[model samples]
Target: MTTLDNGTNSTPAPTLPAKPAVSMFAIGTAIGAILLTIITAISVGFSLGEIISNFGRKNSVVEGLLNPDWGQIWSRRSRSAFIETLQLAVLGTATGATVALPLALWSTTFGNPNRALRTLVRSFNNVIRSIPDLLWALLFVTAVGIGALSGLLALFFFSIAVTTKLTSDTLDGIDMGPIEAANASGASLTQMLRSAVVPQILPSYTSFVLYNFELNLRASAVLGLVGAGGIGARIEFFRGRGDWEKLWGLVVMFFLVVFIVERISVTLRRRLI
Candidate 1:
């Protein structure tokens, strides 16, 4: 039995090396972010104190809020001014969005039959967007002699910038399979877009248009500051006359309009998105 046991000698199992512990990269990042936040807080606190001390001497902030002019808000002229602002926003948004649809399609690679054409269209769109709407309003006011037309023109261009960018992005993210299938079935570019892409992105496009309308509403209210014809002109008039009561009413009206538009936009976005 001993002779038989000597024929087979058992070997020990090999030991596997342990893995090194993971580094605390996440913790380090957190610490760095905390330090940055502390620095930013200190800077903001100092700036806020300076602002408070500067404004405290005038006492305009307290007087403005505590005793707003409710009577002036109910005046017929004020109501008319508010209506004019709304009309300007609505017209501008409608016109801008309508024009933007074609431009958006042209700007996208998918809609462009030729690569060079697509590049050109995209560049033009970029150029248009680069110019601020207020500047456009100023130029138009100079040309059109300071009226609602100038405000309308400004809002229209602004809407185009917003709508085209959003629509092009939506077109870019669409499912390619449908596009390919439409092409395979001998669909024309117009047919393919109408049948495949438009249907899919219509909801998002509508939502964006609505959002732009809300923005235009706010813009129209200020367009009168440049003599573009809206509540902004009234605000300027009251301010020039030193009628703080009327000015306060205009401010309240502006706030109310903004709040209402925001609420509607939020509700519509929620439903659409």
Candidate 2:
């Protein structure tokens, strides 16, 4: 409002320009999420009442968790199963993560310039990733006949999916200056990636491998359910016999080892990154 200096006259206040409204993209995202939630709930038959009615009921899972036979930790079978699980995890992570590195690099433009090859690699990676660890185990078990080899194969594809996705995310954000300089100096694609790209993401890549190992260790415990081998087979036996206490004990013992390894891996990853 403007006021006259020596008079009682006033003019209406001038309004400043309006600030921008919320973005359509943000609004659309919110709307889409709400719609998706609604659709998912409907499809899944989500019901709070069902959960409310069931929550107070006694369950074998709860009983097992409450009364785990910790003495099972000393069983020779348990020990052997645990060792097998560890071997499966180590071997699977080693093989899968090795292949994942090349696959991750090839999926990027700077690594594999061939559009068709890059797309194929990306599509394959995506397909492998879309399948869950359990499903992989089932497929491998079917193909190879229920054994540790099948479990190893499951973890292999699983580790590839995990490591490749995580590593590829880092690749796109690497410092491109060195990449350009390497190319400018007449280095070949493989040499540039090895020299320039590898150094930048080695820490992250190693960390991903370690993390994938941790996951494989945990997953290897259940692969036995599908006869793919490892401690999972013991778990299935315990479950089938309704030996909840022993089953829980085996599960707990396995996880304790996993917990310790994960702690060590976390420390290493922190040091790497």
Candidate 3:
């Protein structure tokens, strides 16, 4: 406090606190990341000059990319492949999501009474999630032979992994009041879960299922390379024959379809959540 010109007491302005110093740990981490990136780039023979020169050179692949055959969209074979891809995505999401809910619930302590069973369920979920979607497709393809059946099976397991993981995370945060109430009221385990748990997470579960469908649709294309069956197989066919024009056309159409579906899914998910 200080005396003003008119002899009235006045307070001085407050001083702001000094900012904290950067930590040694953060500095070390940044330096380590930079060193790692440089080493990796060197190991991979990264060359900007080569990349630019390659792109500038006249090549059939580049030419075909520039002049895609748009008419492939009208081809009956392409259309059939597109439909098959859609079917795989739909069926995979449906079946996978259906099984996922039960598995997710059973893995939880409140849902499954047996500790051994819960541990087993958790282990299964972990194993499924650890495997990539492409590997699943490849395994199924080898086991079932080249066909749509393999693609469906691959998507099924993939969907289960995705939806179950997401749903289980949601379950962890649910209100326990309803669950405890149901248990105190002499409800069976299944009854308690149905009345208390399903209602809480159904919206999130549905949103996850929709998101999984999008993933399945994109994955179906790649699965075709393994002969699991879908638009990917057709894409692979064009690639094998050096038909880049047709391949690019299919890619463009697929992009358009994916974009439209993504918009719809986003809208629905926004409403759900």
Top-lDDT structure, candidate number: 3
1-273: candidate 1 lDDT, tens digit per residue: 443444464634444555657669978899999999889988877576788788777665456656778776568887788888899989999999999988998877677889899888888889889988778788899998888889999999999999999999888888988888899999999998888788888899999999998888888888888899888888888878877766886788687868988898889988997
Error of 2 at 77 (Å): 1.2
In candidate 3, what residue range of length 10 has the lowest lDDT sum? Answer: 1-10
lDDT of 2 by residue, 96-184 (tens): 99999999999999999999999999999999999999899999889888788999999999999999999999999999999999999
**Local accuracy of candidate 3 as per-residue lDDT tens digits, 182-254:** 9999999889999999999999999999999999988987889989989998999999999999999898889
State which candidate, 1 or 2, has the greater lDDT: 2
- Full-model lDDT, candidate 1: 0.84
Ranking by TM-score: 3, 2, 1
As a TM-score, model 3 comes out at: 0.91
Residue-level lDDT for 222 in candidate 1: 80
Q: What is the lDDT of candidate 3?
A: 0.92
RMSD of 1: 8.5
Total backbone clashes of candidate 2, pairs 3 or more residues apart or in separate chains: 3
Which pairs, if any, clash in model 3? none
